[model samples]
Target: MNRIKTDWTKPQKLSLVALLFIIGKTIKESWVLILYFIVRAFVKQNEDEDDTEKRSDKLIYFLLLTAAFLIFFQIQKFIQFFKTRIYIKDNELIEQTGIFTKKTKTIPIHKIQSVHLVQNYIHRFTDTCTMKVETAGTEKTELELSAIDYLKAQDLQEILQQKEAVSAANISDNNSTQLMGLSNFDLIKLAISENHIRTLSLIFAFAMSRLDDLRQFFGKKTDAIIDEQVNQINFTTSIVAGMIGLGIAITLAFSVIRVLLRYNDMQLTANQKGFKVKWGFLQTQQKMMLQNKVQLISWNSNFVRKLLGIKILRFFMVGENILKDDQYIKLPVLQEDVLKKLSAYYQPVWPSLNENPNYTHPSYAWRVTMIYILPVAFAASVALYFWEPWVMIIPILLFLYFLVTFKIRHMKFIFWYNQTSLQIQKGIWGDEHILLNFKKVQHVALETSPFLRRKNLATLVLHTAGDSIKIPYIPLTKAQAIADRCLYEIELDKS
Candidate 1:
């Protein structure tokens, strides 16, 4: 396949921002015009004469505004023509641009961590996409190829994947497997257990609610019409109409339908080689994740999903911000059971679960309540003596709430270590479970506060390849021993 290149026009790239400016100006001006007309119509005498003159003046102002916009558009096009040409080579990508001074950047392929293809509404309609390539070696060395043909984006992805495979092969790791398509059973489990229908319903509702805002910004000037309609409804009638039982039912039904339509033939497959994700309704996207580049795995679930035994799994590659939160890849809908089974295939060296009876820390709730309630109680008692005696009851009630909330949510924190791995667990609800291999650990630190030192206790912090894990409130000697052992393990692995 031919490699990808991007040559974006200035006006094409800045069209969205231009539209935003126009919409903002139009709204402000229209509001002023409305107030002027209202004053002329109701507050002033000889309203007919003023209204006719104001209408003619408004037409002239609009014509002048259009001419100014056209002048700005021409200037933008001229700047774009001077600064636009990006080229991608077999092992390097380069961007060349300049108005007065030329600038060029060449990025090596080996350093790249991930490649992404993104499309907005306009891009989708125009059959174009933007490609972003990120590297691991440097922080600011990002390559953006904008306004490329959709096929060019896919071709670019494939090129990067092949380059990475060759680089891995050069390093002598032969384990590689192409991802197989997701099974029908797996999809059904993902749909039901992950609450895909519910999630889709929420997305649809959120999108629909934004319609009014979107119309205000993007549609013609119609604020007065909308406001008039809104004001016409009686308060009692509006309250009755606001009953959302029917809306909820419709949302749920439509959400399930949307999920089915969107993921009609969804598939996810991965092996030691790389991961492949393919799905869509109107526009399809294919994402690749090299196995060796995988950095972290995280799982989350809300209260309802937890009750239903569902969890969402996300994977972070070494450097890619695949999602807004910096996650590299995610399985949006996956049953906990299905995820467990899939983990074995994707993560062959999954860390072993560690069980430790001796390791424990105070619950977060206990800490939060104790931190807040103690001071409040002391202050309230002193105030009660000088002020209203009822002040004592206020503090008492606050302390009671704190105590109850802490007791209900506080749970034992545990950290465990085995020959090859370390595990940390905490939280009463939505428990966080972290597993890290010993080899992945970069360093270890032992910390002790004045209180901890007085109690003969300290905290052990484990710094891994990607992130850090801490086990707080352990015996001081034990914490020191753990830190030393981890440091020794790191040295041993390197040796």
Candidate 2:
């Protein structure tokens, strides 16, 4: 067993106080702004003011309000800092915080879902990181330790890991006769089935777009000069050359920055117990996932990434939402062959070979496409009454083409099931692969639209924790059978 004691430094405490002040100011000013607007609306005499007078008054009022809010918030923050102390004792984590309330929470090692060490530019400069520990719950009850030295952060992580191992062993010994385990091969399949490259490419493109926006905002003058130069290159050849040069420069800059920011010292490993991830540039983070805690798995690939042979894998754990953290354990980039091998371990239920099974949708796509087409065609017909009738032809043709694409895409859907899991694969341009444990399904629904009812076809939807997945175009009887089987499986698992 190991122990670590930690506290915030004076500067770090000031930073935390500043953060609280900002929050308080924002909240306080929000109500003030609303009230000021309402009061101003009644005082119409003041509306005829010179612009300079109005601006000056606004600035003075804002500064005064903010200063008062900050002064009060800083006092509250100082009291909080004086009261809080965090320390790890052997296999248990403890947080003793609060001024007048005097609250203390102790989380045993086994309950911690994940530990995250985060640092921004300021924290990096100070060689410290914020340690956050998540536990099992729907509420955002995270324990945060701010401004811990980098070496101390690493030492705490090791201590937590040791406690986790001991707790896991104890639980396994106690429950060995009752629990069913997911095999190492299953984890491997999960890793492989994820579309790593596609996911990475999408991530890269998004980062590049954001960076481009930031640059444009900060380098407005430089951008204006570049635009003038670009416009001056009037020759067709020179224009093409200029565009190509700009594109290449942007792409190279984006790629290097993205690789450095995201995958600096990236690592991924797996064991029979769980998956492990270590990544980051300034504040190295370690994330561990116990096999049983994983609730669902998904893989997604957009059209661009699919063309480039890339895919992204996502794991939904039992209690926490990955979207909140905005950090995912990634393979970074992987070849198709490597993906195939990893997919087998992570997503064994997915078919190894591409199966061109006939895909069918309930009448929903047709309804949606017709709904889209009717409006455009109606508008076009109305327009032709006043404008060129020829304009109608172009819109009519485009609408028809769009409708056809929707129909074709919606007609492509497939669902598969085995004794242990239900697999669903669907999408038009970007495919979505979902794997759900049959036991976790809360309920099953069989529904039919008017058209489907006429056709004697129905859809089956399985409801889980947060969302539901549907399988369409099955016969009514078959849909009922699937629903029944799912319900039985859920019951059996519970029993």
Candidate 3:
């Protein structure tokens, strides 16, 4: 095994600013605010002096203090940086570092599931990036290089992949063929199809919650101006129209910019190991997943995508996808051939209903989900009974909700088990297929309530390292059979 230390380059030093928001060390992170308070204290002490002279002195003192504190802080960071080290020995990736308390971490190279490089807005200014090293069985990164040279990070990533390749005997995809690449025109189409209202609502919520921070960063008082304008207007007359128009304009602008920058000229390629995607305009990222490392493969589509005949294929990788919520290896607006290629790489282990016609949820499964909705509906109707004409719309919505739930829950809620894998088909608005191999199953839970016990119905839950799959409203006998089979498969694999 070979070993090396970080170069500790100039860009890494500048990246300290980025770490202010990240890295939750209370004392070290609070330095800037501390410096501001110290300056304020110094200014307050000299309050007896003349106002003009005091103001000049305060400005000078604040600048001097800011410079001194930052200089000392950088020196401290430099010392810590110099002490930081990375090395490999005996099939282990070792990282040793810490300021006051030294910490050493040794991770088996084989256990390294995913290597991620993350860069946000601050990374643009620093010309450096973060290397997140995650392993199986954990949501947190095992080791993280917060600020490292971008090229060096890539070199390290290649080295890790090479090591993993040696271990798994699959380094890259053999075909080395381009799977999909989004052109500018395609990106434009994506921008048009995006659901701006939902995006805008998220933006509005975040902005409302973080107005002070945004004001400090962007130096725009328009938020205050808008608030004043809204308060001036009549509450019920045209507020909805005005807010919607503003939201639409903001959403459209944000959607266009976001699509162009985030998904600009994105490309996906397949090699011997698995597939890798390279995307982003200003700040580029390369995300790859190996077949062995992928725990799950799922896809989703909104109304726009369904209309456009496109889908986003998401990779539920074991070690690499630690974020859990956000998919790193996502192919957006996947064309036909790419979908076929993806399916070929990751086929469903579970057989379709055509192959196993007997294992399906009963018609009462529709009412299983309705059990959750009726209570809420009763409360809503009672709450809104005073609002007569307006309340009439609620029942219409309630009917639609029940109709959709009934249509989805009863018709396609199916699960089939074979010796190799279990297949689950679910979802209402979108088609979601889950294939769980026996080896990947972490645990199996077979549950039955009083009602389910009375009806001989049960719910089966299968947990993996990444996520859980639940099959609700199946016959108890079937649930028990599946659970026993899962345990039997686990024992077989072990033996």
Candidate 4:
């Protein structure tokens, strides 16, 4: 095996990629100032004035000011890059940073929750990656090496993983087991089945935001430009249909391209220590998660994926929420057998819905309708009456939609628990399953409102390190018993 001969104990500077990273960071951080300068130079200019010399002088002054501002920031970042140093010693990761004011941070090795290696296009070209270290209880990345050697980053991550294993007292052998990998055909299938409507909505939202920005610059003239463009378009039924088809085609193409780039060459593996997922085409990312640190495991499938026999599996480690889709660890389960095998590794005994499962109270449907649908219906009735009475039909349709769906939603909801774990089955058209270990429950609470109290029902909430699960509108006695059992299991785990 080939190994790099760099000592991690001694302080070391970042890779040369840091120069590019620093430049990019400076530009991103100063974008608002850049925008302000551009707006001032354009909006404040007196184009109608005949005094050419005065305008020339003003332009020169603006150029010099912008140049000086950018130069100052560049110098500051350069100095910061030179001064920053990092090293691992005495079971702690230490970093020293800052140009004028010095600051240092130390994180214990055992406290690290995960180590992520990210390689964007620039880093890929330079054969480097960013190393992000996250510790338990921190809301954000605790330490980041903006640029480091890709191979060295993996070695350092393994070292940290070993330290975590020792702390947990559950070290395993050096054999890695491959859990999942995607082929080119599988990637095509995955891309084809993705929700293209969501992608189209995102694209439409971005276009609208850009239009608002244009409105700020052009004032009322922006609307004039839009109207002029619309007038120029020869809108026939065929043309309108062609445009809609073209838009759909473009959205699907974009989605396919995006999925291919982001999830190309994906692999998931597990060992005694933990799980590691590697994926990407241009910008590769590797996520390492410890076995014992994973607090919640969930698998959700939409209508399309359900037909394809696929589901997206997510692992929620300590201190992680619903982060950027790319940041959190997720895998596409292609088969039920694969999902069962992976589930067995994380949770030995996956609970099934009982023949007579604990369903929500009979009032669940009506209560959900009153809480969610009534307010919107009432607001729409008031607003639409003053605007367009005909539009009131929309709110009526929406109310009926929710009223029917909530009844099916309540029927679909099931909560099952055993001595060791809790299983929640939820959703209307699609199936979503969540598994939580009793030991992972950090807090349990029983909640009731006047309505619930009158019906002898309460809501039980179980809070874990990464996520929370709520069993709403259950019998008060059952809710209390569930809470007490969770607390007892947590205390037993401590012993």
TM-score of 4: 0.87
The best candidate in terms of lDDT: 4
| Candidate 3 local lDDT, 283-366, one digit each (tens) | 666665566666666666766777777677777777444355434565785576677577566664336634574344564545
* lDDT tens digits by residue: candidate 4, 168-197: 856766588898999888888788878898
Where does the lowest 10-residue lDDT sum fall in candidate 2? 173-182
- Tally clashing residue pairs in candidate 2: 25
Candidate 1 matches the true fold with a TM-score of 0.63
Better of 2 and 3 by lDDT: 3
Candidate 1: list runs displaced more than 4 Å.
Answer: 1-90, 119-127, 137-141, 165-266, 279-284, 319-323, 326-328, 332-358, 362-368, 377-412, 464-466, 485-495
How far in Å is the alpha carbon of 371 misplaced in model 4?
6.2
Instruction: List the candidates ranked by lDDT, beginning with the highest.
Output: 4, 3, 2, 1
Q: Cα lDDT of all candidates, in order?
A: 0.60, 0.62, 0.69, 0.84
User: For this target, which candidate reaches the highest TM-score against the unseen true structure?
Assistant: 4
Pairs in steric clash, model 3: 172-271, 172-272, 172-273, 173-271, 173-272, 173-273, 174-271, 174-272
Candidate 2's C-alpha runs over 4 A off are 1-69, 87-93, 105-112, 121-127, 139-141, 149-237, 244-248, 282-284, 319-330, 336-358, 362-365, 375-385, 388-394
Each candidate: RMSD: 8.4, 9.9, 6.4, 4.0
What lDDT, from 0 to 1, does candidate 1 have?
Answer: 0.60
Can you write out model 2's per-residue Cα lDDT over 1-495, one digit (the tens) per residue? 755443322122323433444455556756765566667668765446689678967876986687677667656656666666666665667777677788888887677766677776667767767777767655354677665666666666655654575566533321211112223343333333434555457667887898688777877675677679878866798878997787655655555555455556656555434556666665566565554455567777666556555556666665665566443454533355545444444455453234334355546567776777778777877787578766777777777787777776666567666556667777786777777776667788888778788888887888765357777777787677668777888889778
Could you tell me every candidate's TM-score relative to the true structure?
A: 0.63, 0.65, 0.75, 0.87
Question: What is candidate 3's CA lDDT for residue 110?
Answer: 73
